[model samples]
Each structure stands twice: as structure tokens, then as C-alpha cells.
Target: MFGGSRRVRQAALFDGASLPRKHISLGGWCGPALMLGKLGLRTEAYPFDFSRVTLDGLMHFIQNGFAEGFYPPGPPPYRPECVGPWVLFRGQHTAFAHFDLNDPRVQAHFQVKMHRFDAVLDAPERPVTFFRTVTARHPQEELALALDLEEAVARRNRSLDFRIVFMVHDQGLRASAVQLAPLSPRVSLWALRYRGLPSDTLFDRTHTAYHAVMLHSVAEENWSAVKVGVVPPPPATMASAEGWDFERNVLVCDGAARTEDVPFADLTITRFPWRSHDNLALIDGVASVGGTCTGIGSTKMLANASAALHVQRLARLKCRYCGDATYHAAGRPFRTDRPFTDEEDQLVLIHLYKILTGGDKVAAVEKLAHEMRRGTYEVICRIQYLTNSSTKLMDSFDPNSLSDP
Candidate 1:
């Protein structure tokens, strides 16, 4: 999506004040023709096109060629010097890379940078009134003291050494403060370690020796995992139709309706157990899955039934054959002008029978519907009703019945 070819044309202008007499040379023609050839264009057409090209047109073409090469590949790699406030140093091999700026080992390390900010009190602004009240009780030695009473333990012994231990008890409390003030609590401290001093000394007699001091802080910004590539799910198939078998507790469409064998990157399956008696389906247990079956065009009863039962639920419940519409439960139909036909009634009856019998005839009907391209219920109902009517008509004229009358 990022890289593609482009073409541009530019015009040349000469000012009388700058150049008293100037003839614009066709220098632009040479650059474009050479570039086009390098980009896989044929050199033979160069002369024919070049002669007709204007200086402006030639300049535009060159600019277009440069634009095509501007967008390269993925983003440039991270440079440590260019890194900002916080650097996300992920474990490369097993060893943790040093954050020392001078360390070459850290130079090649892959890290993500982030920014942070903090505030300090303006100590110089305090007036003599506030300073006197705060400093009046403290001696000059106490005021200049760098170590607290606990830190003075170093003065009693020389062999004793102190260690700074840092533990990240929790990673959740690292939020930036809204404002800075003298009374504002220090959220966390920088632990310091040193050797003991002499009993009479004001400072530690032993020089401080430094070791690794873990700096624990949280990013001031949100971070998200960078997605590389994703493999999608396989396309739907007949096996997926097992999901639609509610009696088996597999209430999904098993994808038996797909005609093509091509695989898809992703597929979604849903269950519709309550769709069996859905009013939208002229024949129950069948409802269009995606959209209405109207545009499917002059299909047989089997196609319509399959679409309703297997493919999707109807967007609207208009008869596929006659366009006689039905309401969605309590909703009004577009028009109630047309009455239900005998064919529709028969289809409905057969579907009702199947429901009543706990789908006893479903397997046989499904097979027939698929094979004949005529819906099983509709065809069977028409035949049964016609035969019964004929039998009744014949019985009315029976010799025994006539004698009794």
C-alpha cells in the first residue's frame, strides 16, 4: 500500500530582470528519459516522446520519479542517542544490557523511548519571615547536616559497610503529581550506601563506594503490543453445519450451503434455536441467514426453503413464489392486499406436521428437497391434499352411501 510509481511535470520561468537574454535549454529531457529507462521503461520510445516534451513537462516527470522512490520499507530502527526520557530495554539474550551511555553493548540494544517530567520547589523565593520561623530552632551544624540519626551509625565503626537495597513492591503507584509543593511527600527515595565514619568526625571518614542502583519508574505514556502478522480462520464448510443441529446441542449452521471449495481467512458461526417457529419463514425450521431470499430469482421451492432453513433468515417474509407477505410477529406487513394461496397453506401445514412429530420426516424431506429442487413439504402436502380431496369426491357418489340417503 505504501509504494507505487508516480509522474510529474514542471514548467520553467525566466525573469527579464534576472536574465537579459536567455534561451531555455531542453536539459530536463535528458534526466527524465534516463530515469524512465532505469525504471524498466523502453529506451526506444525516448526520442519520440522527448522531442514533444516541454521543459516544464520534463521537470515534472523527474519529480514524479523521485517521489516513487521516497517511501522505502518499514520504519527506521531505534538509535540510542536519539532516545528520549524513558527507554524500554527488553531482554535480548540473557544478560541485561547496561544503560551507560558509553557502553558499546548498549548501543546496539533494541529499546523504545518515552518521556517524563517532574517539578522542583523554588527555594530562593522564601522570605526572611518564613526562613526565621523554619530555621530558628536548628543549630548551624544541624542545618548543614546531610545525614539523619539512623545514617550516623557509620560514624561508630570503620569496617562496617552499608548497602542500598531497592525492591519494586508494586508497579502501579508510578503516576505524575499534578503540582509541586514543599510539603508534597516524596513518593519514593533514592537509597544511598557508604562506609562508616570515625566517632568524632562530622562526615564519614571512609570514602563512598558506588555499586548498581536500580532506578524504578513507570512510563508516563500508555504502551501497546506491536502486532506483526495474523493468520485468519479457515472458511466455512458443510462440517460447520453441525452447529445448526439444535437437537444435538450443535446450534450453528455447518456451512453446508457454500457451493465453492475456496478457503476463507475467517469465518463466524452462530446458533439460532428459536428460528424454527419464526413467522418469517413460510415453512418453519427454515429462515434466511444473511438476507432475504427475494433476489435469488425464480428459484424452486427447494432453494427458497434451504435459504430459509440453512443459509439465513428472511429480511422480509414475502412468499418466494407469490410474494404474499407475512408480518414479523407484531409488525405490520408492507401491504395486506394479497391472501395466502393453497400452495402456501400446504407448505405451512407440512412444516407444522414436522414440528409436531419432532422432525420425524426432516431427513427424508431434506434429501428430496435437495435432489428435486422442489421443497419436500410443499410437494408432499400438495399430493396428499389432492388425493384426499379426490377420495372424498368419489365417496360422495358411493352406491352404499346413496342407498342410505
Candidate 2:
């Protein structure tokens, strides 16, 4: 949400690159690749590009194509671990899938159809004029129902009003699609990982993908609270303190030596996820095909959320420095005419507590000050310093800074 600058373009491209971090900054290969030749990034280019994409559904097609090919009905040709570095952008819907097994002899059933998953992902409320979800259940039937689609097609032929989406799951690529489309481009699959099983020797096929999504299931923990038009506040702990030496980073960013721009090769490494406390293992001992750490089985994956944590920290630090510089260079207009009232002082501390803690639930700083053995007066003094320095710093830059404060 920035004006006509690099920041604006960065925000626009987050969908193509990864999830929304606290903020987006120009770095690695992205900065020069997108910006320089065009005399750096522009805000106008982004919105224009977005509107065009939405109007034509170009990006949707690209992502849809990626997901479709990511998992094949049959075995994969190459080692899944050798594959990858697939970019993950946030989806409009949480994305889901559902399939049911029922007796084939029972003719009564409802069929779900989706012409394109991208359309649903783009607009969940877009009227179901065409593609919608359908899963037929045949209790007496087996998964092998996939093999007998000819009978299923005949049964559908007998019905006067047969919506194409409802059909036997075992139908071959063309048989299932013949009624609705040559091929139903829509696929409700997300969060795919490699399955341990290899391809059958008789027929070479794609590796079976164990996907987190199905036909019509939303990921609850990540997407249930669909509060329309709500903007999430920035993350308090910019980056987990585990990686960068916070204190040192600040000293360096505010005063580090020999700073050269880092490249994006390992910018590849930056987006990996961490081990959640879950106990598990890989599908077939093939954790990840790509060089990056997005493992398949028991291997822990790095969430895109963490990628920008540190980046924001660093950017925010530099941003504060730049803001202060810009302010001074412009002659300290940020020097508010009047001092903060007592109530305002408390409010400022309260805001700080809210921001620097566990997502507004707990005031980590208030407790941290105590744990650090700072007496009541020191805490007050620290708060005053923080308030004075940071008031102008709000909306100044991205988060995660260089080193320790």
C-alpha cells in the first residue's frame, strides 16, 4: 500500500513471490530484474498489471497450470526430490477437495463440478454458474469405480439433466471430461507433498502427491476467519530471534561495516520453513527434490511467513534511520511542537506493549523489562525513549533490522 515507488511494485508482486511479509523490500535479483531498466519500480505499473491479470485471468491460468501438473494421476517421470523450488503465493480461498466412495449399483447421487479451480480461488462468492464441486458416493463400489466409467457415462446419458461434474472418480482423463469439457481444467488441490510410492514398472507415471487439499475442504486453522476488508496488523516479533543476532544486527545496520548486497541464489534458501513440533517422517525417504529445504516426508519445511521476518526487521531499522535522516535533512519537522501529555505517555507505552508482544494478547516488553531487572523507573525511562524515537518511525519502513538494540 505504498505510493509510486519500489515498495508499491514489491507489494504487487508478493502474490507471485510468496506470502505477505510485514513489508516488501527490494533486494537480491528482484530489485534490478524488475526495477532498473524501467528506471526503478513504479506504483502505477502494479495496479495496471493486476487489473489486466484479473480481467484476463492470466495469473490464474499460470498458477492453475502449475497445480495441475504438480500432481499427476499416475507416477512422476523424475525424482520428486529432484524437482521443485515452486513459488507459493497466497490463495484467495484456503483451497480444498472432497471425494466419496459409494455402491456403484445405487443410481441415485449428486454430482459436483468445477470448470476451473483458479476461478474459485479467485472468487469464492462468484456465482456457481458453471464449475462447482461434486463427488458421487457408491457404497457398494470400490475405488476401482475409476475403471468402469463407460457404464457411468451410459447411466448419465440416460438422465435428461446430467451436470457433467458428477461422475465416477476412476474415469480416464478424457471419459470424465467428455460431458463437461474436453478436460476439466479445474482442480481442487493444494499443499502437495511427495508420496513414498514410486511409479509402477509397467507404466511410467508421475509420483503420487499427498495433497493437503481435496475437492471442497478449507484449511481451518489458516483460513476460517474470513473477515472481509480487514487488514492484519504487523508482526510484533519481526523475525524469530533464533536466526540473526538481534543486538549485533542493529549495531551493524545502524553501524555495520562492509555491507554488500546479498544475491538471490540462497534467497532460495531464505523461504524454507521450520520444524513444527509434530513427529513424522518422509513418504519414501525422499524429503525434497529441489535443493531447497521443502522436504516431502518427515523433513521439516520452512513457512514463507518466516522469510520476511528478518528482512522486515532489517528494513525497519534502515527505514527508521532513513526516516530520521529525511526528517533531519528536511529540518526535523517530526519534532512535535508540544510534549506528550501524561495520558499520551501511557498510551504510547501501551501501544508499544501491544506491538512488541505476543500479538496483542500479552505485553512481552512489560514483562521483559522486569525480567531484564530494570526497576520501575528504568522501565518508565525506556518507555519514554521508545515513544520519542518511534512515534515518527511508524509506517517508516519494513521490519527486522540489522542487529541488537
Candidate 3:
């Protein structure tokens, strides 16, 4: 019923992070996005990755926050500039655009200080090469004349010493390139954790945009009505199982726990990072959405983790009694192993979701249980616990409801 690809690692990392399985949603970016909200960063969510729906989803929450105030409120209110969507499509004009640097709107919408489309540090040895690299997306008269586009941007911004966010793929993984990128200040280079992009797009510079598949599953819902969390559809994608799993690419930005390369992790300068599942338990602020500037499905960092753990953790009260390690007690091999497959997990999720959201539907749960290969009784017991627990939690005022705290 559900389909998406997010493979897990051979071993899990539960060290230091003792988060209750219930609080974490594994697999998809949806789980990670929800996890971010749980961490109090007040995530402004975007669905369909780089599609128009993504922009619509963001605008939906932006206007919602303006109209109804952000759910799980905080002091000073949540603003768009303080938040970055889970991903962005840089090739889109409006998607990656910055208004006139001097305009009030620019400060209102974005954090960038430069007015031009490109920002570079120091003069380049090969200005034409640099021009081709940076200005591939921009068709400017000044660039055609072979002007020092980098210098012009610097002069226009009135700052020679600045930061460069030069993002690349695994092929661009030269430590020397980092030092060569910017002459002053510091350059925060983003390297994709995995290298599985299209043949021509080994390194994403200009002209990089999100594919149309970004909005494939979402069409019925009004983008404006959605919040910055998991979208509709009872069970989130395999993203929860594969895409959001902490053990996989780790959909949730469990902070810099997954960060490497630099002697010390720099939140201000690290590349696209997904953390261990337990990483978020140690953090106290909004997760840095990272620098994946394309569709949602492509990012390993935004997907990942255990199948049994995912179901038990996310199905609310109905999931409370589900035993994940029971197979060991019964002298049976573990059902799921490293490098998870989505179809089987989808069955588990479908059965559990029926319990979580449709507690009254006895036939539906039974029907799903009947369809499964084994362990039907255990599934029923767990779902019953989840339903009862969820009812109790829903009937009370809870502190966990305070998202920003």
C-alpha cells in the first residue's frame, strides 16, 4: 500500500539518546519534520519537496501563524525568517529568490545579506570559469561582457569579506577545494552525504531544481490548510521506516551528531546532516533542515530506522503494548533486518494506523490482522493498549503538548 525507498544501516545507535520509542517517528521526512516540531523549533513544513505545493505548504503555515498564531506557542511569535523549510528547490526563481537586499521585504523573508543571485569571496583566477559556475542560472548583461561577477556582487553588497555557501556532491569532496572556495571570512560548503543523483548533476550548482515527482502523492488537500508537520494519509511514507529512521539516513535532524570532517562540528557551517535517531533528544532548539536543495525523496538524511520500533512509537495509545523483540523470546528470527524493504512495513503500518485512528472499527483492524502472515494476537494486544493510552492522553492536558518548551 505504501512505497518509497529508505534503507537502514547494519547496526543501530542508541547510545546516549534514550528517547522513548513513542516520541520518535522513523522512516520519512514527515517523521523528522514532526520530530523537529517536537523539539520546539516550530518547523514551517513543506510538502511535495520542490514542487509548487511545497511553496503552497509553506505559505499555508506562514499565513496560518499570522492568522491563528502558531500551535504550541512561544514568546515573540514564530516568523518565516527564523525558519527554513525542510528542503528547497534552488532553480526556481521565487523559491530561492532574495528580494532587493536593501528592501524591507528581503529582511522580512530571508536571512541573506547580498542583493545579487551569486555571492563569492576573493577575486578568481579564471573569471570566465567562475562566471560559468556561478551564473549558469542567471542571464545578465553584465555577465555576458565577462565582467568580474564575483567582484560586482561584492561591490554591490559593499562587503569583500563574506561567506560562501558552495554546495556540491561527493565528487566535489576535496578538502583543498574548501580552502580554495573563499578568500575571506569563511565558506560553509555543503556536500551531499550520498552520491546517487542523476549523471549530469553530480554537483548541484546553478540550474538545480526539484523534479516534478515532488508533489506526486499530495493533491486532494489544500496546501493552505496544512501545518508544518506530517501531511495526511494515515501512515506517513516509508520515509518513517526508511527515510526517517535514525539508523538509516536519519530523517530527523538529530543535530550534528551525524556531522563529520571538521575537527569540531559547526552548526553554522556543516553540510546536509541527518543524525542518529537519538540525537534530537539531546537538542533544545529548531533542527537546521540542512542544505538539500531539491525534492524530498532524494535525501537520505531526511529518511530512515527500525520497523517494529517505528510502529510501536508512532501509533499513539494503540501502540503502547506492541512488543518489538518478542521474536527473540519465541525462538524466531527477527522479521526485519538491515536495508529495510517498504512493502512489508506498509502492511504493519496499515494495521497499526487502523488501531490508532479508527479504534471503533473492529472489523477493519481484524481485517488487516487477518491479512498479515503471522503474530495477529500480539498485534491486537498492542493496538488495544495504544487505543486506551491514546484516549487517556487525549482526555488530559499534557506538558508534551507545549512544542516550544
What is the TM-score of each predicted model, taking all chains together? 0.14, 0.16, 0.20
| lDDT of candidate 3 over 81-165, digit per residue (tens) | 1111111111111121111122344334332312111222233211111101111111121112222323444454454433222
Candidate that beats the other on TM-score, 2 or 3, i.e. the better one: 3
Candidate 1 regions exceeding 4 Å error are 1-359, 385-405
Over 4 Å off in model 2, which ranges?
A: 1-118, 121-235, 238-243, 250-282, 286-405
Off by over 4 Å in 3: 1-164, 172-177, 183-405
Candidate of highest lDDT: 3
Worst 10 contiguous positions by lDDT, candidate 3: 128-137
lDDT of each: 0.21, 0.21, 0.24
Query: Looking at model 2, which ten-residue stretch has the lowest summed lDDT?
Result: 79-88
Candidate 1, residues 1-405: lDDT per residue as tens digits? 000113332222211223211111111112222222332222123211121121222222223321211111112221111011111111100001112222333233211110000000112111110000000011221112212311332332223322211111111111110011111111111111212322211112111111111111111110122111222221133244322232442223213322122222211111101111111111122211111122111111223333344321122233343443321111111112334467655654565465345442323333333333343333333434645634221112221222121
Quote the positional error of residue 265 for candidate 1 in Å: 14
